[model samples]
Target: MKKIGIGICIGIMCFSSFFSYGNEQVLPHHHQIQKGSASYIETINQEKNRYVNYGDGYMIDYPSHMEVDTSLEAVRTLIKDQEREIEIYYDNFHNTPNSAPAYKNYSNAFIKNTKDHIKEYENTATINGMKVHLLKWSRKKLSKVSNDKNFYVSAEIVKNDKEVYTIFIKSSRQFYNFEDYMDVISSFKIIEKKGNPSINTKFKPVERKLNEETKEFYYKYFVNSDKLRWGIFEQSAPASFSYLKGIENRLDYEFKFLVRYQSLDVPMPLEELKNAYNNNRYVELTLQTMHMNEENESITYDILDGKYDDYFEEYAKKIKEFNHPILFRLNNEMNGDWCVYSSYYSSKDTNLYKEVWKYIYHVFEKNGVDNVLWVWNPHDLSFPNFKWNHYLTYYPGDEYVDIIGLTGYNTGNYYPGEIWRSFEEVYPHVYNEYMDIFEQPFMITEFGSNEIGGDKVKWIHEMFDYMYMHPFKNIKVAIWWNGIDWDPLRNPARIYRLDNREDVMDTFRQRLKDYK
Candidate 1:
C-alpha cells in the first residue's frame, strides 16, 4: 500500500498551470493562462462549504463533500463520483489584435478535452448574471465493457475580455437538476488573498472528551507532552507479548505500547488488548474494513448501510468495559490504493470513505465508548495523489478524530521498485505539513527500516537520533514494525526486526538508556 500510494500521489499531483488573474500573479476576470498554482478544495463545519483556493487565488462555495481534481494542466475538475464533474479551465488570458481573443480559447480547450459526445440541448441564456452558452449532451455507448449511456451536460461562454470559461458537469444516473449546475457556474470567482495558501490550519477540534479524570490525565501527561513512547508490532500479533518480553529483558527497556493490524473479517483483538492492558501497556489497533486474507473485497458501503452495526456495537461495549485509553486507529493508510477503503475503488468518491468513518465514530459514541481515542491515520503520501484522492480528503473532521496518526516505511530494495529511505527523508516532510495544520497530537502509527534497503543498523541508530531532535512538535508516540513482509516468490523479502542482532539491540539499548 505504501508503494502504491507513493506512486500515485507523486505522479498525479501538481498545483500549477492554472490561469493568472491580475498583474501580481493574480487570476484574470475571464481570461486563460496556463501557468499558475493549485490549492485543492476541502473541509469546513459540515455546512454548505465555500472553498478558498489560496494557491490559485479563488473563492467559491463548492459543496464541501465533493472532491477536487487538478491533475489536468490548466483545469480544475470538481467531481461527484464517476458520473458528475465540473471542469474549470485556465488558459493564457491575454489578447492581441493580431490573433483571436485569449478568453475565446476557454471554449476551444473544452472542446479539445471532451470527445465522443452527442449534444442534447444547446442554447444561450443568463442564469447567474453571466450570459452562458448552455449545452446538455450524452454518450450513448460508454465503453466496450458497459454500455452505460451516462448523461453529460456541457456549455461554453467565451467573451471579448479574457473572461472565457467552458461550462460542464456530470449529472447523476440518467438525469440531473439543472439548477445545480447553474449554481455551480455562478459560484465561480477569482480574487486575491494576502498570504501564501496552506492546508486549513484554522480548524478547531470538536469538543469530545473521555471520563473527567482520565481525560485530564491523558491530556496532561500524554497528548502533546514531552514524553515519547516507543511502540512495536511483532510478526504474529497473538504471540507479540512473548516476543516483546524478550526484547524488554535484553535491554531492560520496555515498550509503552503494542501495535496490531487486523481486518474486520474477524473479531476485535480482545485478547491482545487484555495482554497489553494487563502488562500496563497501551494498544494501538490498526483497524481495517477489508478481509485480512483477501484484499479485493471492500465493505465500506455495507458498513455505511449498518450491516455491521451489531459488530461495532459489541466492540464498543467491550471497549468501554475494558476501560483503558485504546489508541483506536481505524483504517490506517486510507489514501493508498492497496487499501480497500480508498476512493480508487469507489469511483473516486471519497464521501463514502468519510461517511463510513463518521458512522463508525457515531456508533462508538452512541455506546458511550469514551476510553477510545479515535486515531485518524493516512499514509505519508497519497495514492494517485489527485486532489480527489489526497489524504486530507479522507479526514473525518476534528470531532471524529482525536489523534493524527502517520505511517511510512523503508522497504529496502526487496521489491522490484521499492527503495531505501532515511529517517530524515521519511519523516520531516510530512511532519512539517501536519505541524502547521492539525491541533491533535501525532503518532508514528507504524514504521520500520527493512534490512534489505541500506544499513539497517545505521537506520535504527539514526532513527533514535532523529526522534530525539527537539525541533519536532506534538509527536507523542512512535511504533516500530518488527516483522517480515514476505514475498511469495522471495520468502524473506524484508526483515524489520530490531532483535535480529545483538548489535542492533545494543544500538537501541544504548540510545534508550540515555533518552530521559
Candidate 2:
C-alpha cells in the first residue's frame, strides 16, 4: 500500500456529543443518527470529508490533518499526526469460528508482545455497530539514559467470522486525548458484507434477437443442450486471439473470444473484429459507455440530458456498417459499485439506469444495427449495497435485451482481511435468484479467482462441475477473465489464465473434454 495524500477538513464539533450505553460511551456520529432525525440531516450535510476504502471490506472517514500511510505489509492502515500515531492491522485467523475467542487470543498476544502495563481493559465494547474488545495501557521509559517518560495506548480489537481488525492508537501521555481518537475509531464501518434486502420484486423478461450464426451456436451449445461454450478475455483482441490459438492447439478446441470497449475516447477496434471474423471465431463485445476516469459518482444526469447522443449515434452507425453478428453487452455489471451507472450513485434510482440502457439500445435500433445480439448484464445482486428488487428495475424491457449476463469472481483476500471464497459460494445465489424470473439463456460474461489464499485448480474444476449440474440449464456461455489483474492498490492480483499453472490448465483441458 502506497501513501496517497488527500486533504479534507471535517468539522466534527457539530456532532461531538456522546451518549452513554451501560458502562461504555459512544459518539453520536453518522452511524448512530436515526433516519429522519435532525442529527442525521446534519451528518449528511457534513459528509464531505474524504473516505479511504480499505478494499478489504471496510472504509473509514479520516480528518484532513492526519497523514495516512497504507504501505505497511502488516498494518492495513497507518494514520499519523505530529507525534500521535494510529495503526490498523488486518489479521486472518482461520480456526476461530466466533469473535469472542479470537478477540481474547489477540488481546493477550498484543499485551505480551508490547510489554505494556494495562491501566484498564474491557473484554467487550460496541463501536461502529461492531462488538470490539477495548484496551487502554501505558508503558514507561525503561532506557537508563532517558529521563522519566510515559506513552499511552488505546487499542480496539474487532473480530468478524473470518478476520480481525486491530486498531492501535499511541501517543505521549501529554498529548493523549482519548475522546478525540475515539471519534476516529467510531468512524470505521464494514462495507463488504452481503446486502440486506428491504424489498423484493419479480424478474422482468426481455426480448432479444440473435443472428443466424449466433442462433446456431446458441442452439448447439446452450439451448436444449448441456455443452458449455468456453470464452476468454485479454487486454487486447490480438492477445486474446493469440491465447485462444494456444488453447486450441493444446486442447484441440477453439474458443469464443471476448473483447471490451471502454469510454468515449476509444472507438471499436475494427482490426480486432476483423481478426476474429477472419479466424472463424465469434466475438463477445462488451461496450462500456461509462466515463473511464469516474467510477464513484453518478453519470445519470449526463445520460438523461442526452449529452452523449452524438457519440452513441456514431457508434451505432459503425455497428450497423460492420454488419456482423456480435454479442453486444452494453454497460455490463451495472449493479456493482465499481461502475458509474450503478444504483449506488444513482440514488438507488434504477429507473434512471434503465432509461440510459434503453436510450443506448434505441440508438442502435434506430441506426438499423440488427446484427447485434444484445446481452443485458448486471453484477450478482448478492453484493453489498445491491438490492434484489433493484436488479429487475434496471431492465431495458424484453424488447431491448436478448440474453442475461452475470459477473462473479472468487476475489480471495485481494483486499485486506477479505475471505477466500470458492466459485460455488460466489455465483450460485444470483443464478438461483434470477432463473425463475427470466426465461432467457444465461451467460457468465466475467468469471475468475485469485491464485493466492485458495486452490485455483480446484476452484476451476468445481466451476465446470457446477455448470454441468446447474438446474436452470440456461447457462450457455462462460468466459474466463484471462488477463492479469494488475491493480496496484489491491493485494495478490487475481491471475485467472490456463497458460502458466500446468495443473490448473490441465484441469481446464480435461474438464472441457469431459463436457464435450
Candidate 3:
C-alpha cells in the first residue's frame, strides 16, 4: 500500500507526456504568463517559492523551476519539471457515500478511464491529519513506447468532510529524485472553513439512573442464558438491519447483539444506538482508539495518562443518556499487534493497557453509567508469534470486567501458508486458559469462518455442536461477523456471511432451534 503511491507517480508521467506541451506552447486562460509582471515572475523564480493559493480551500508550495497547470477539472493545480510532475485534484461529489467508498469509485474510474493496470492499491498513508488512499500502476503507453524503459506511477488521495483531494506525483523510477518532490507534496495544506464545531471539553455529567427494563434484559439474556444468544455483524447499519429482519423471519428468533465500531475521538452515534436499543438488541461497542498505522501509534501513554478525563466523562454521560445495557469492549483484542493499545506497540508494557482500561472504566462508573457491562476482550492465542503470550496480564482485574470476551476466527487459508482449522482448534486452548484464570461468563465477541479451503456449513455445525455440548457451559453469547472479506481495492480475507448460503443458513436456523 505504501509503495503503490510511489509507483503510480511514475506511471502517470507516461500518460502525462501525451497531454503535456513543450515550453513554447501557449498557456491556458488561468495560467497565462502576463508580460511585464515582474513581481509574479520573481515570486516563481525564488529558490524557496512562495505558497500558491488556488482560490480553492487548499494552498501548496512548489519549486521555482516547476510549471503549474490549471486546465484540468477537479485538479486544483499541477506542477512539473523535466523529470518529475505533480498534479492536485479535488472531488465534491455530493451523491457519493463516505470517503472509503468514494475512494473505491475513484480508483475504479481511474483504471477504466486510463487503460492502466493498477498493480497495487492501499489506503495506508496519513498526511496533513487526513487519511490518504494510494494507487500504483505501470503505464500501458510505456510498454508501447519502449520495452527497456518502463514507467511506473503513484497517486495519493486525501479526503476531508467536504471534498476528496488527490496528489498525483509522476517521476522516472530510475532517474527521478523522489526526495526533492516529496518536500513539495508535504507542504500541501487545507484551509480551515469558518464556524467548524470545536471539540466539547466541558464535562456535562448526567445523573440518569439505569432503566429497570435494561437491567431485566441484561439479567435474563446475559447473566442467566439457557442457550447462546445469536447475532450478526454486517458492514453497514441498513445491511445489518435488513439481515436481522430476514433471519428473524426465517428462524423465529430475534438477534441479541448489535456489533458496532467506535473510532478514536469520534463520539458514539447516539441516534443509531437508540434505534438498535429500540429493536431490543444489546450493542457490542468495540471502542477502537487507534488509527490504521500500527507503527504510528496515536493513543500513547501520555494521552491516556489522565489527560482526557473530561472527554471520557462526557462520553460516559452520553452512554448514560442511552440508558441501555451495552457490552462495552474497550480496546478489544488488546493482545493482538493490530491495535495501538496492544503491548506490541506500547513497548511491551501490558500494565499501561490495563491502566488505560481501568481509567476508562472508572470514568464510566463516576458518571453513573452502570448500564455498561464492561467486556474484557482479547484475541485467541492461536495467532502465530503473538507478542503478548500471558493474556492474564492484559486483564484489568475481575472487578472492572463483567464478561470475558474472545475473538477467534477460522481463517481457512486466507493468508499464505494458513491451514484450515476447525472451531475447536481455533478457540478451545484460549478458552480453557482464560477459564482457569477468570470466573466471569465468556462470550465469543467475534467469530466466523471462510468457505475457501473448507466447508463453512460443516464448520458452523461444529461450532454450534461444541457450544451446545461443552461442559464449561459459561460461553453464553456468540456474534457472527457477516461481511465480505475480499474487496477489490483492498486485501482479501475470510468471507463469513451465511445469509446468502441457504445450506449454511438452514443448518444455523436448525441449530438455533435445537440448542437447549
**TM, every model:** 0.68, 0.58, 0.56
lDDT for each residue of candidate 2 in 191-280, tens digit (9 for 90 to 100): 554322111222344434546766666556556666567777766564346656776688765666565656766776666776778877
Best by lDDT: 1
The runs of at least 3 residues in candidate 2 whose Cα sits more than 4 Å from the true structure, single-residue gaps closed, are 1-225, 238-240, 294-298, 381-389, 469-472, 489-492
Q: Number of clashing pairs, model 3?
A: 12
**Candidate number that wins on TM-score, 1 or 3:** 1
- TM-score, cand. 2 vs. native: 0.58
**Tens digit of lDDT per residue, candidate 1, span 268-305?**
77877887777877778778888756634336645665
Off by over 4 Å in 1: 1-174, 177-197, 236-240, 295-298
Top-down lDDT ranking: 1, 2, 3
lDDT values for all models: 0.63, 0.59, 0.59
- lDDT of model 2 at position 414: 62
Best by TM-score: 1
